[model samples]
Target: MGRRPRQGPPRPPAAPADIQLASDPQPDLEHEQTVEAAAYYDVDLTNRLAERVEFFQCRFKKATLAGSHLAKVRFTDCLVETSDLSNLRAEKGTLERVKLSDCRMTGLAWSDGLISDATFTDCKIDLTNWRFARFDVVTFEDCNLSGADFTDADLRGASFTGCDLSGAQFHNAKMAGTRFRTCELEGVGGIANWEGAIVHPDDLLGLSYVLAGALGIVVRETDR
Candidate 1:
């Protein structure tokens, strides 16, 4: 008998109430502070270094985290929508039950991080690095992940639906129970090690061609 199907991504944490809003010239900017149930709008956090900062039930809208280093940071029940995360680096960071929608994540590096029960919807993740990262029940829905790197990442029980994963790398990754739904896998690497992964039958058409080329196999017609 085959293994049981993995469960879907866990639900996001509930939004907190009575959260304090950040005022102009935010004092918490670049400061190692714990802000809970807060909403930050249009904040400019460029090149900020946040170490051990924790944000719970927070919403960061149109905020910029470019070139920022977020080490050991925790974001729970947070909604980071329409935010710029370009060149953002997170080391040993954790994003649990968080949703990042419509966020620009190009060149973002989350290596050696823990991302559980997270949803990255409609985000641009091209050239993003997730090497050595561990993901559990994470979903990348309607996201552009072209040229993204997931080498040595543990992506068990993760799902990518309606995403453009062209030229993505999954070398040495743990892909147990991973699902690919309607994703563009053209030019993707490490397709040979997709054991226990689930894909639609139609997806095999594209994947087969890639694997065939890698193995130098030629297809010829023998019947008229």
Candidate 2:
């Protein structure tokens, strides 16, 4: 019998219409503050430092969170679009029911974070760090994830589609039920720990070579 096809994660719910528009041009975020049900646009929060902050049912459009350090933060039911989130470090953070689109997120580090029901689309997530993170029902589409590190991460509920995963590291990571489709898999590290992960048939040829290299197997032509 052939292998059974795996299903992708369910899509997250869209934002509610009742969310209020923020009267302020920018949000005044302090440590351990919880901001909810507000819509912000063009807020410049670059290089800000805060801890244990929470955002619920908030929408950020064209906001700049670049180089921010928001440790132990929580984000739920949020939509972030066209944001500059490069080099932002949000270690030990929690993200649930969130979606990010058309964002520049390169060099972002979310180590030891918990992410659930999140989707990232058309984002530049290259060179990011997700070490020791846990993902549940997370999906990435049309994203550039080259050189991202997933060492010791739990990716059971993660799926990638139309993404660039070149030079990504998955060393000692949990890969059960992880799915990849129409994604680049070149030079991906930690092929030895890819048990129970599903990939499209089109990507099998590249993945086979990666597996061979990990096993130290060389393919050579034989004379007839």
List TM-scores for all candidates, in order: 0.90, 0.91
Reference-based lDDT, residue 22, model 2: 74
Per-candidate local distance difference test: 0.85, 0.89
**Candidate 1 structure quality by residue, lDDT tens digits, 57-127:** 99899988889888878899899999999999887889989999999999998988988889999999999
Model 1 spans > 4 angstroms off: 1-6, 25-32, 218-224
Model 2, residue 133: displacement in angstroms? 0.6
TM-score of 1: 0.90
Tens-digit lDDT string for candidate 2 (1-224): 13232345645746766887778665566899998887778888888899999988899899888999999989889899999999999999998889999999999999999988889999999999999998888999999999999999988889999999999999999897899998899899988778999899988988888888888888678779
Q: For model 2, how big is the CA root-mean-square deviation?
A: 3.9
lDDT of 1 at 64: 87
Index of the highest-lDDT prediction: 2
